[model samples]
Target: MHLFSAVPRGVLTLLFASLLLSLADAHSYFIVTSPTQGTQLQNGAANRITWIKGLLDDIDAFDVEMSRLSVDGLILVARDVPAGSGSFNLFLQDVPSADDYYLLFLNSTSGVMFTTSSRFSIGDSSSNATATEPDSSAPTVTISGGPNPLNDFATTFPPSANGVAMPGWKAIEGSKGQLIGLFTAMMLCMAGGAFTLL
Candidate 1:
């Protein structure tokens, strides 16, 4: 009878520990990328707010909620992002005028977990001024140095003694004909240069 009672107590203790561990591991990690903190946007403009959650772990989906503070400084506008997989890209449209401020929250559908806060002021978007320009005048330019034309060229590998070599570069001589080909090409180039000089 003592053995039976001890077994029950041990089982209960294990259950309690497991519950504590589960609760501790329930929080999710998320990052807000777009409409960054302290960003300003214009009213009725498209605002792209980005967030990432649990990048290391495989999750089913997540959600985002956005709200606006009213004239009385209260949370008035609230929106929710539906369940989806991978990273989160939420494009909120028709953001209200400058008189309002937004507070955004992310929660995982798997559990009641949030990533980070999405806060911003409307009517003062960062990109709003760029969109309002009417003049198509070319942007001012101040050239300081000569043009760098070859800056975009792909990097070329040097001649390889043991690995595969690049074109116009010599490879190590083998039982095959790579070294011979290189020798021939170099001789031809030298002869051409001599003829040109003559």
Candidate 2:
């Protein structure tokens, strides 16, 4: 017996079409490429936060947040940053000097964190030994939601042998190839259905 013989032709068509659509709508992963472990970022300086995309299409925008090991909350650094930009300029003028500062990249549309940077030092501990108050204009949010986004360090690709994160497009190409194969299979199924009707 045929595997899909029991299923109606219209139902099978809809199922295959929906599967293709879902694959087509897959979101890309953003990997932070800068401020890696042991890196130092000076406070009051315009530091650049860069990232690379992985697999499928990029999201419209994402939010950037700064957090510290000693700190108890997440600080909003930037919001609605365009995904295509691939980088953001962060100014920590009012932030204190800390060696455990890290960045978080969150999807702006869904408020879900996608990636994070390793803990790095911020500001010169010798120059600014005391903790400085954050900027009054900057809004702060407490971590009271479901899971802590800080603990989630999700990535599509593993670090290279040198411990540096590198981006690859092979996964994207593989996904495209799979989609094409599925499309071809769907066409064959339709043709088979037409022949059965004759």
Candidate with top TM-score is 2
Tens-digit per-residue lDDT, 1-198, candidate 2: 767778887787788777766655455457788878877765545456677885445455566777777768766556666666566555555456668888888864577778899888876534543333333443332221212445432212221234333457755564565667577778868776674775
Model 1 poorest ten-residue lDDT run:
138-147
Query: Model 2's lDDT to the true fold?
Result: 0.61
Candidate 1 accuracy as TM-score: 0.35
Query: Against the unseen true structure, what C-alpha lDDT does each candidate score?
Result: 0.40, 0.61
| Candidate topping lDDT | 2
Please identify model 2 stretches exceeding 4 Å from their true place.
1-27, 125-198
lDDT of 1 by residue, 88-138 (tens): 322234444453354344332344655545456555344445322212221
Error of 2 at 30 (Å): 1.7
- Clashing residue pairs, candidate 2? none
The whole-model C-alpha lDDT of candidate 1 against the native structure comes to 0.40
